[model samples]
Target: MEVFLSICLGLGLSASSGFRVFLPMLIANIAAMSGWISPAESFAWLATWPAFFALLTATIAEIGGYYVPFIDNLLDTIATPAAIIAGTLLSTSFIQIDNPVLQWGLGLILGGGTAGMVQVGTGLLRLLSSKTTAGLGNPVVSTAENVASFGLSGLAIFLPIIAMVLVVLLILWLFRKIANLRKTK
Candidate 1:
């Protein structure tokens, strides 16, 4: 049960990373520093002051970049891969499995996969919004993504089950939306 909860929390955080790579890491660092959460032994550095400040800087830059006009689209290309790496690290930090191989394997597969899928969906949404609204709606989308990343990261830390359920539902909804878009095209 503990392991299950850990996986849920990790995946939830990973999904949050998909929306914004650095936000989830910043939240986790703060949580760990405040004694609200404990990362794996190897990830103990995540709770340190240097890590906090670095993540803070990255988060601010990433969020601000998304508010820019053409820069947001350019950032998405780089963010996709960065989000996957962040997701894998976030998930791996929570996993308590005895075997390093199994832990990293699951982290790479589930964590990376979840983050990648969400990132793809968000990129698509941004593209559609850019096309339909002449890029005027992008700031709104960026704001929503930021909010979702923060909310999901908090929920993942405090309520793993609920966060996991929300992530699952979000993935399902994204898949359905993509399918519908395919049908139209």
Candidate 2:
């Protein structure tokens, strides 16, 4: 039961990472620092000050970069792989398991997969926004993604089960959106 909840928490945070990589890490570090959550034994560093400060800096940079016009699209190309790594890391940090192989494998598959899906969905939306609005609508898209990242991270920490439900719904929505986009192309 505990493992399940923790995995749900990880998945929720991973989904948030899909929107913005560092924000979810920052939020999780804050959660750990505040004693709201406990990371896996090896991930104890996640609760430290250095990790917090580094993640803070990265988060701010990531958030600001998205508000820029062409740079946001460029960032998306880099972010897809980064989000997968972050998602896997964030997911693995919560799973309190004895078997290293199973833990990491699940983290890579479920967490990375979730983040990649959401990232692709957002990337497609940004492309559409760029084309339709001539980049004017990108900032709005960036802002919404940022807000969703924060909101999902919060829910992942405080209400993981509900967060997981929302993440699943988000996945479904992404699937539909991606399929429609492909059909249009």
lDDT of each candidate versus the true structure: 0.95, 0.94
Candidate 1's error at 176, in angstroms? 0.9
Clashes (N, CA, C under 3 Å) per candidate: 0, 0
lDDT of 1 at 184: 95
Question: What is candidate 1's lDDT per residue for 4-91, written digit by digit as tens?
Answer: 9989989999999999999999999999999998899999999999999999999999999999998999999999999999999999
Pairs that collide, model 2: none
- Give the TM-score (vs. native) of candidate 2: 0.98
Worst 10 residues of 1 by lDDT: 91-100
| Candidate 2 ranges beyond 4 A from true positions | none
| lDDT, model 2, position 112 | 93
TM-score quality measure for candidate 1:
0.98
